[model samples]
Target: MRKIIVIGSMSIDLVVSSSKRPEKGETILGDNFFTTPGGKGANQAVAAARLGEQVYLVGRIGDDDFGKEIYENLKDNNVLVDGVEPVTQMPSGTAHITIADQDNSIIVVPSANNEVTIEYVKKHLEQLDSGDIVLLQQEIPSETVAFAIEYCDRNGMISILNPAPYREVSNQVIESATYITPNETESNAMFKGNMEDALQAYPKKLIVTMGDKGAIYHDGNRKVTVDGYKREVKDTTGAGDTFNGAFAVGLQKEYDIEKAIAFANLAASHSVTGMGAQGGMPTLLDLEGEWHV
Candidate 1:
């Protein structure tokens, strides 16, 4: 299997379960609260590792308790942390999440995560071999993401970009990526039009993930839709990350794009059956031996 490198944010997620969100200027009681090690990068790394991939996580964390906890969480999941750095002056990143009716609202405070620089990513690229898979998300600096995409292009590696939390990305970054995985909202933000146009623009490189509608893959000339699996959803968090991680593993294993998306869809559906991000992600064994192509 090819090595997978995940570059993005690492955070401590404070998750609360409530019947409804409190209106402005009103405080409401919550059903439950729990702390989990999360962040897009860490979640993807853990997802991939659980699926039997050799994964390395690259991101920045603070020298605080949250940072320590997140680091240990990654280590415990068998994700390599050689590329992780600790920023002494800042606190670790954090996300305040609320889940209601199986939907979620999140507010992220990117502290040390903002400290991940282009230089840091470049340095870590030295540890990757040619043809290795590099997975990235929008939780970190866009400039660093752009640089990493271009660097991977120059190094003959496959670069997959997951534009989550929706932000404006440069054309250079878009074109540099070998694959761009974006959900409906992100696709709209990036292309400013319908999903078809986005796929037309990026061709096979653009993968649009539609929550329960499954995913669509366009190869410029043709479009294919992969239906999502049916499952009881407890929480929707980390489902996309799970899909992306599984997709990367499928690619690393040389599966065709359609097969890869199928694998991803199944993995993502399984993820929603549990609560929390990393906690809900399914392992290869959990796939009931159906993960194989």
Candidate 2:
């Protein structure tokens, strides 16, 4: 079995439904509101652990009610949470999300997440190995991400970066990754909306996920595109996270990148059929049935 380590954010999300996104200085009535434990990092960690991977999560949350909720959620999902810390002065990271039918907007305030430093990740580096899969997202500091990826590289562990809420990461960091999974928006943004614009220097493979359109792979030399599964999407909150999680499982199973993305694509399609981020992910059986892989 492959050991998987995920380093990122663990946050509580407050979601509200409205007919339209509110404008500045405008008050809009909402239909309903709900709270869920979510953070791209935490969601992927849970998704991987539930799929039978040996998983570890490194993140930070406020030393408050939300932190307890996050900790319990990870434990209940069988994810190792020893590396998750509680920041006393900082509030737990949280999101205020607004959903209007198909479109959604989010405002994330990184409180405790802002406090998770490279030192925090360095302390947890002892558990890694060449057989392990290390995953890091951008919810925390870029420096921490650099440290984790560098440590994984030196330790011979394969590192995968899911550049969700995409931000600029160093080319050196990108090159260090075994793989970088970016959704369409992130990819386009990272590439400055020029698909023809080549970023040939990255040493690792690149996966660009286009919702409904499917995923494309550039693994150093060849380029392959995997068509996506079709489903009536209820909410797409955690679809990308599901894709990355399932992809990690595929890598652990030694499936090649193309096969892994296909598996992950199917899993992501399953996730959008329901509501919530981690709430809607498919199991291994679900992926098998949906993709017939």
**215-261 in candidate 2: lDDT tens per residue?**
88766665667899889877788888888888898888888878888
Q: What lDDT score belongs to each candidate, Candidate 1 first? A: 0.91, 0.82
TM-score of 1: 0.97
Query: What's the TM-score of every candidate structure?
Result: 0.97, 0.94
The clash count for each model shown is 0, 0
Worst 10 residues of 1 by lDDT: 284-293
Please name the candidate that would achieve the greatest lDDT relative to the true structure.
Answer: 1
Model 1, global lDDT: 0.91
Instruction: Give the best candidate by TM-score.
Output: 1
